[model samples]
Target: MSDPNANRGLAGIVAAESALSFIDGAEGRLSYRGYDIHALARHAGYLEAVYLLWYDALPSAMELAVFEGTLAGQRELPAAVLEVLGRLPDASTPMAALRTAVSVLGQVDPEAEDISHEADLRKAGRLVAQLPTVIASFDRIRRGLEPVAPDPELGHAANFLFMRTGQAPGPTAARALDTSLLLYLEHGLNASTFTARVVASTLADIHSAVTAAVSALKGPLHGGANEKAMEMLLDIGSTEAAASYVDKALAEKRKIMGFGHRVYRTEDPRATHLRRLAEELSVESADTRWFELSRAVERLMLERKGLHCNVDFYCATVYHALDLPVDLFTPLFAMGRTAGWAAHVMEQHMHNRLIRPRAEYTGELDRPWVPIDRR
Candidate 1:
């Protein structure tokens, strides 16, 4: 018999055990392995965080160098993948293009059918290296420009900026981006991560799992929130209009994207760092309007709704200040989250299980079938 007390959307359900990340929702704390997120965000590089997520320990200096070198060596996409991106229509969204490219990568991978741990780790590293290239290539191609080749000398975050802009990022910009990527490296069983883990449980390749994760992330309620938040700011057009727009949105019961979270009763821990990045970048860019407006809306939302900002809220301004288009925001998220997704996939594969779950029946039981002629 099905339990009538089933949790809708699997709320409060512990689907699987993981050693990758821990979230204290009531306390508003997040950690990777046992390292606190704040400490990692402040002190660790993105690649270090990636290593920690994948291996469950921080890498030694020599190990990190080798890891970074291995990842950098894999940055170039398959020529066939680039050709595919070149042929995609200009209007194709970045997420769609990324999904297609990753699937194509699976097709071309030598060990595509290999489910072994070593092969999966290699595939994960390749994906981490190549996804930013895919995103940056698509962005440039769509704008009638050639893709910028990645600089091997730069680290992951800086290399991404260089690929996107064809120039090395300043220390501040690089650090801000590095911090953002580090902050987003992992979280506890987020929607997209769960999707990745679910696909992995089916014994799919890492690429397929990550491809499915990207699809899940394309939804507005997941990875698209930051892009929508940026749109809201742009729609308001000025700081002076922020309150009126927010008030009208509240009165109409429209969702104020980026202002709340499913798990965090207090503030999202990641938001604190992103909010500071937004402020820093805005000041450096000599345009504080977006950050100012974001703060205003945040204050109003809190006063009226008692909601706190999630990671997506201030990230809109930060990315905007970096001159990234709104559409690419989610792809950037996928790039950062690739590490976490791959980690979850690895974890799921290590402890294999089919993820099938029962649905509670709500319809008439054992209904008699009628013949078509009789009916």
Candidate 2:
């Protein structure tokens, strides 16, 4: 039998270091490149956050505008990739199609084999730019709707919303999404980010690294939390049932998808901002039902379990208020985290080292092999 005390998930293992993001789990503090997440979520656009993560500094006004333009220009998917998306089975999950599309994207990139810093950076930019297109295209194709072309006039988050719904998002909705993207920017060596770094360590192209990361994030324990949280609230249906729902879940020893974090002993800092945003958008749209239910569930969870909600909890209501389908939640998460994954990929390639860890042996020490035709 395997040793029960081994680091089953490599928890607390510091595999490598980079100047990416910091999380003070004990105090519920998070910052990216020395900037607090709260400030970024409130004041920065998603493009700015992407630049900061990749370049390690905030860009100037002209520089940011140039960055945005470059990304916008590259948002249109190649014809081959679009054909592939259309060819996929209609019932394919968004994440499954996204994973395949990203792989196909690598296959089509002329510089897919290049690992130099300059080439990697260009590919990274394309991943950030084209991911929204890939997602929106697959979604529309699966639903029997024509994919919308990228709108250069719109910012990154706003363009994604436009592509999804075929309508330009207003300032409040646009800013709300932009803030959420910044807030989801990155965390230190989470599963998907680590997966990106690991793949990049092999000198894989940025698209390959990003594809691996998306696959890792597709797991229910990771990226699916937000979707499950929304399902929970939707099932609960009202603030009146929130307490009982939580109570029953707790009494039955069911896992509450959004309450606990593997790293944070306190509430997730991102959740604080998302909680406010969820309510703001809810109130702005004159539909506070989801927000109220979220609050009630949050209060009950904290009171009974002494657990704090993570980023996924309030994000459910926030995305729901944005009128996003619950099924797209994880894909949206992959969309946000792709920037971070690319950043990690670049960092790993710059200081490449194969992340080969040892596995503990718990089987019999010297087992004699049986002959194939033993009597």
Candidate models: Cα lDDT each: 0.90, 0.89
Tell me how candidate 1 scores on lDDT.
0.90
lDDT of 1 at 179: 85
TM-score of 2: 0.97
Candidate whose lDDT is highest: 1
Kindly report which residue pairs in candidate 2 clash with one another. Answer: none
Residue-by-residue lDDT tens digits, candidate 1, 55-112:
8789999999999999999999899999999998767899999999999999998889
lDDT of candidate model 2 versus the reference: 0.89
TM-score of each: 0.97, 0.97
What TM-score, to 2 decimals, does candidate 1 have? 0.97
Writing each residue's lDDT as its tens digit, candidate 2 over 1-375 gives 676776779888789898999988998899999999988888888999899998989999999999999999999998989999999987889999999999998999888899999998898898889989988888888888999999999999899999987999988888887888787779989999999988888787898888899999988789899999999999999998888888899999998888899899998999998999998999899999999889998888889989999988888888999999888888888888888888888889988899878777666777788999994
All predictions: root-mean-square deviation over Cα?
1.4, 1.4
Tell me the lDDT of model 1 at 192. 94
Error of 1 at 263 (Å): 0.4
- Backbone clash tally for model 2? 0
